[model samples]
Target chain A: MEKLLDIKNLHAKVGDKEILKGLNLSVNPGEVHVIMGPNGAGKSTLANVIFSHPEYQKTKGSIVFKGQDITNKKTNEIAKLGIFMSFQQPEEIAGISVFNFIKTAKNKLSGAPVDFFELKDEIAENMNALSMQENMQNRDLNVGFSGGEKKKNEILQMLELKPTLAILDETDSGLDVDAIKTVSNGINMFLNSDRALIIITHSTKILEKLDNYFVHVLVDGKIVHTGDKSLADEIDKHGYSTFKGK
Target chain B: MAKTQLEELNRNIYDFKNPDDYSFKAKGGLSREIVEDISRRKNEPKWMLDIRLKALETYNKLSLPTWGPDLSELNMDEISTYVQPKTEMKDKWEDVPSEIKNTFDKLGIPEAEKQYLAGVGAQYDSEVVYHSIKADLLKKGVIYTDMESAVREYPDLVREYFTKCVPLFEHKFIALHYAVWSGGSFVYVPSGVELDQPLQSYFRLNSPESGQFEHTLIIVDKGAKLHFIEGCSAPKYNKVNLHAGCVELFVKEGAYLRYSTIENWSKNMLNLNTKKAIIEKNGKVDWVSGSFGSKISMLYPMSILKGENAKTEYTGISFAGANQNLDTGFKVVHAAKNTSSVVNSRSISKNGGIATYRALVKILPEATNSKCSVSCDGLMLDSLSKSDTIPVNDVQTSDAEFSHEAKVGKISEKAIFYLMSRGLSEDDAKAMIVRGFASPVSKELPLEYAVEMNRLINLELEGAIG
Candidate 1:
């Protein structure tokens, strides 16, 4: 039984244009797969479809996570089923306290009352993990958070949910060097053999630890090339214009 | 099949109900007999009973509401004049039976009471079956109790404040409520009493298809402060349920009062409720309300500033999802020098729901150097849903300053694209935008309630867009 996510000919479109064209890939339990391509290349689309976003119409495709077909699952349901997606920009949920939002999210994933004392302790701990202020958990969900703070908050949610398959959508973008290292450690903390990670980012700076893993290059809505860890280094040195699937 | 052109709210609980249990009810009508029957049921003094008879005459002369949802369908003959839950008001929490206890329990009244509430009361059906207050508040001379007991025990106190501010002749609904009003809370803050915590009461209409005409009156005396929160709900009914209740608040000289309410009535209700507050010199009133349920509702809390340096702030949000027409807003009348009122409101209409915000601001000739500002924003998730804002500004004095601004718009497609470009699914992006649209109003609510408010917003927003 494959422990990783299997995407088979996943095709999706938004409005009139098709973004993800027949993309295909698979990741092992412990592998960290990075999808990189040009600006319009469907890197983020792949991340969204994997997390069962209601938009991004899935025309023809199948996404199997841990041997379960979740092609048409609700986002919250998909999240509870051990699939997590860290949005590139975390949403600012006004009026919703950070503690209450995370508590409900954790409950949805675990289907139980979050140990109040333990959850508070863990939230205090995870705030330090993301280099966040001690009172961040008490504040409204990203209401007045800065750009880098929003990304860190996304990573903070992912850490608490701790899904078996984590898909991070450019969460490292718009971060300073110090903040980038903090988010990078957060990814490492959630990395394990029993779980797989699908990180979609243009820069591989945060991918320093999990260097040698599967890399897929998406161009024109399709995974045109699949390679080892060095593929990311090649793409960084030479942009997507130098690569061709044929 | 085209979705049923769903209204903005599934407040069908305000619509229709099956009346299998009305207990002993009077045929809805304004007559001496009906009023006498009610007075007989409540066991009122002759003088008080005489007030009911006079109230009936006042009700007959008053005209029905000409604006908002049509109440012509509200047949007086069909409404059960009085329907009491078969229990008495219990001070000891456990003495309250399980069934009635379960209703308040579902509404999260006790939990909120323990957290930061100085007083709490739970009203089931047409009567208050349970009421309590923190001992420290009572010791501080803060009086919080059911209105029925207040009228009975403190007749002088009740006489001093009752109906004087919002008399029965104020309007038709007030007259109707005064005639048949059964259960609600009365909060009185004596001079110099500054309550630190909120006082709460949960109202539940459990008997199927019964009319609930409860009245809540709170008076903050001179140099005092208080915060009162009200919660209301009802079980679903197949017939048009009615809640023509009233609430009047009096914030006296240099006093302040904050009232918060979250009403989640079932979808079959015609929630034609009324509330008003009058502030004297140097007084302040803050209103925080969330109207998320009701089939057809026309509710607007009004504030009247009548003394120098008086101020008021009203923040409200209404969500109309399916089969609901919630026409709700607020009105502030400035009648004194340097009085101010600030109103911030938002409405979300989706799934064919209809949401409206209609308000009136009238500054009297003597209201010199007064200021008032109103900002209303509406977001319609789909083309079929509708949002409207009708505000009237009547400034009698040239020294009064007032501004009314509103915008009705649909969710931006570009914003959705921007969020999706940043990796959020279209649905998530839409939810985030809608959530943020309501942030101004929800942010004013307390902690746990804000989450519940967001959840209700999400529920109403799910199929609002493609």
Candidate 2:
């Protein structure tokens, strides 16, 4: 099977400080890849670099998505090319209702006219599965939302966008156990034989609920260890200290 | 996504101009002759002319405002204070000259009237070319007509409340307005009557290097309610144009009045408008305004709560694009116990434009137990743009409760990135954020006008990104 995303010796920096140094990873279709690292290990940097964040500079290497070189594509272009990232800290956009925001995004992604009623129904059902209030769709996007609710909102957007590759960056950090379960369930529903997910997380609790996943231990700006799901449990039991200077 | 080509402002709807064919155009300058010519041409009574002569004298004595946007470019000597269209006031839209009628037709004045308004008045240059009111409202003793007609038909009522709320001595531009003001709306709702629909007046300044001075006077009688809407626009001109219109509203005992205005003047225009309302016991007034054009603007609508339990609310927004300076805010004076006020204002500046919010809130010693809350926010689209908040809050009575909040900020890069990551282009993301920032004010407008305002914002955002 062809690789969904291939990153080779990716070296990136934000401002004057280099973050992602010589990082390589390959994600295949239908696989759940979990990246675990200590603080400053450049885990989140990898997620942002894929999107070509304006503040981050790609000093070296390349990122290929679905046989297309998107190393320097604009954020919106990358998004349209079927890449979605659930932000660690979701932005609170006032005045735009969640429903309208999702509809606009879906339309832009598909480049077609979306039926309003069908989109509304889809949002309602997804929000229901995530245990969100029925009126959440009417409220401003992420404005005044609780931490758990914001995380759920990100999941809701991921499920709605249905990208070819979805990256969840620290989405479970601030969530409670119940919220973590809901987010995991959302992830389980999103994964399919034709899709890929890269979950950059620190907790093994979420990994326990996810299946058919691999764990990669990142240290000092590089992924030094990669194994099956047992690797996540091993790292969770010990720590990133064992992977340091590897 | 429907690709929107970024270019200079798509202001063709408002920038198209007709030939300057008119029956009369007052020569550029401020003098007794021009002022008297305006009054005499309207066939006004002697008393009105005397008031005009007095106001012209006051205009000469009063100096230009020292604070706010510079007025050095506004040479009254080069501004024709009045331009009478080549037609008489017609009760029917078709009776108006084709050129002038086509202008209003292009503006959708007749269609808006047919769809929503209880009455409609169309002003071109300095004259009211068309005026009409629903027969139902006329039967209810609701007198809606142009200012000149009101001066002739209902002299007593017009004289009583003409300049009562906004006196000529209030400012230099107001004095200028009194000297040559023409073609505005006059609405008088009878006691205990409430109109379900709004009365609209659209002003179109078509002549170049001229001024538009329309006088809007509304008196909502005791226990009555009314909503008056004012719309103004002009085509682009090389020389400077002036808009110094005046609005005076009287919300009587137990009455309610809501005045809404959307002004989109040409970039070569100076908008120095004055609007005020006086609310009596148990009465209320609401001011909803949107300012999106003008080379420079200095407008601050005021409300005076004179009776117990009188209430007022002001919700306004201003957008200043390249080469525009919009100086606008709200003011309220609490004169009696239990009177209260609330203000919410927002502004956006881009491409080296400047937006300023200057406000005043005063609570007299007699105004015990009063409450006032004010919030103003400013957003700058580029670093070259500027926004400022200068507010004065004076509380004489210790029993009053007051709070004021002001915030000035630029578009958040994080927010923009978040939106762009959701599949929106940079321009689309910026435009969406701006529309969101302006949603609160737009939601306050009538539905059709809200759509129009959003379209205007989209047009303003084109070519906004460097």
Candidate 3:
């Protein structure tokens, strides 16, 4: 498998308090990596730091993506380099339609003109797959949407952008059974030989639908254990108490 | 992040000037002679001339406002109250002078009239050069023409509602407007007649160191409905200019009238304009305003709900960029039983610009069961900008309900980062947030005007990244 992302000794902080302390990980193409950690394990912070979120200051070390040093890049630049993140709690931007936002993002990242008709058809198809109403495209992005609907919208964006790497941060936290199935199916469709995923979750319910994955147990901002799918089952049954204080 | 340049963001698209091309120009100053000369040149009646003289007296007697934005920069002695373009009011577009017509053409007035307007009026400097209404509307007894002609033709009707909504003695700028007001529109929607399309008026002030004081008076009779749109723009100049126009609207019983305005004055302008509406029993008035230009602006469109069950709604937005101070809001007075009013206002300030929203909502003692709700939100793009919300709510009646909400803050970094993570540049992200912030007022405008408002916001946010 081709190496897609490499993180070495990454130490990050938010407002003088270090959250990600010398964390290191690697992601390969065509692989689904599940990151399971207890509370205050810096799960969301790691996702944000990878995207160079302004709030997360990288105090030390480096993050290399697709053989490029993107540690100091702006979020938009990193995004244009084929990186997408599904936020745990997305911000509701009023008066901007979901369809328009996705279209603009796709156009900006690709640096190409998009056919309006084709884009509409593709959006409608993806929305239908997610069981989202047609009017959802015209409504303000994430404004007044239910928790499940917001999560589905995030997956919809991920599918539309077709990024090389995606970081899903707690995407299944607030979803119901049907919504989880729909979201998992959408994620599965996005899985191919050239793409990679980093799934951050507390529960293994969504992982049951995904395959060919590696599970890493992260405790206190560092990955303590790494194994195959059985590791996820182990953590599901025994919890992260074994990884604590390691 | 690279700091955005304030100069690049404050660029003006309407900054071309036509050489001093006027058939008549009054000497720069405000005096009895200048006001009398304007009235005499228009060949007004004795009563109209007397009113102008009285207005001049009032203008001299009243002092400048003490509470709002400063007006120490306004020098009446340096501003020419009137500058008559060469062309007279022509009902046909082809007859208008090319130079003056091109100005309106660049502003998309002719094209807009052909596509969406039932009537169009174009004012240049101190006089309305072009005015026309659709034949169907004319056949239905709807009157839409220049105010000068309205005074000549329908004196009784003009005198009945003129300044009744916004009296001449209300303020110093209003008094000045009444004294030197030269060009504007006079619209009358007959009883039971409803216009399918809006009638638009475009005002262009081309001369430097001059003022554009146009008066707009509209009346919607019983069971009638009408939507009127007003647009203003001026070229930039080194010297200061003034725009103290006045608008008065009267909606009769069971009538509806919507008044929309987009004011884009130059940076050298001191715009102190006034607008008011009087709604009768079961009548409704809606005000949609977007203020985007001018060095200093003090505008508060008022609504007087005087009849039972009357209604008024105001939706407005203001964008104050570098070197601009805009104090804008709305006022409503519930005088009769069961009257109601709703106000939603938004403001954005950047690059040391100051935007203040000052509102007043009053429920009188006899206004039983009256309700009023006011919401004002302000957004500052950077630390250098300033925004304030000052609201006064007085509920004299025990049975009335009044609610007010005000908020002021800078752009959220988390929101910007989220947008940036979606592949939008930092500038684009900030622009989108500001556009969304002002969308409530823009959505209330016509489709084309809403697009123009968004474009204006983008231009104002060109380099507004923090």
Report iRMS values in order: 7.4, 1.9, 3.6
The TM-score, computed over Cα atoms with residue i paired to residue i, of candidate 1 is 0.79
lDDT of 2 by residue, A1-246 (tens): 788999999999999999988999999998989999999989988999999899999999999999999998999999999999999999999888998899888878998767888988998999888999989999999999999999999999999999989999999988999999999899888989999999999988877766669889888778899999888888878988888877
DockQ of 3: 0.56
Q: Tell me the tens digit of each residue's lDDT in model 3 across B1-466.
A: 0112221333445777889889999989999999989999999988788878888999999999989888998889999999999988998888999998888888889999999999999999999999999999999999999999999999999999888899889999999999999899999999999999999999999999999999999999999999999999999999999999999999999999999999998889999999999999999999999998899999999999999999999999999999999999999999999999999999999999999999889999999999999999999999999999988888898999988999999998888999999899999888878878888988899988887887788878877764
Task: Report per-candidate DockQ.
Answer: 0.09, 0.70, 0.56
Model 3 error, position A111 (Å): 2.8
What shift in Å separates residue B10 of candidate 2 from its native position after superposition? 5.1
Q: Considering lDDT, where higher is better, how would the candidates rank from best to worst?
A: 2, 3, 1
- Order the candidate numbers by DockQ, best to worst: 2, 3, 1
Q: Which candidate is the best by DockQ?
A: 2
Q: Which stretches of candidate 3 lie over 4 Å from their true place?
A: B1-12
lDDT, candidates in the order shown: 0.80, 0.92, 0.91
Q: In candidate 2, list every pair of residues with a backbone clash.
A: none
Model 1: CAPRI class: incorrect
Could you give the fnat of all candidates in order?
0.05, 0.79, 0.73
Predicted structure 2: lDDT: 0.92
Comparing 1 and 2 on lDDT, the stronger one: 2
How much lDDT does candidate 3 score? 0.91
Better of 1 and 3 by DockQ: 3
List, residue by residue over B357-387, the lDDT tens digit for candidate 1.
9999999999999999999988888888899
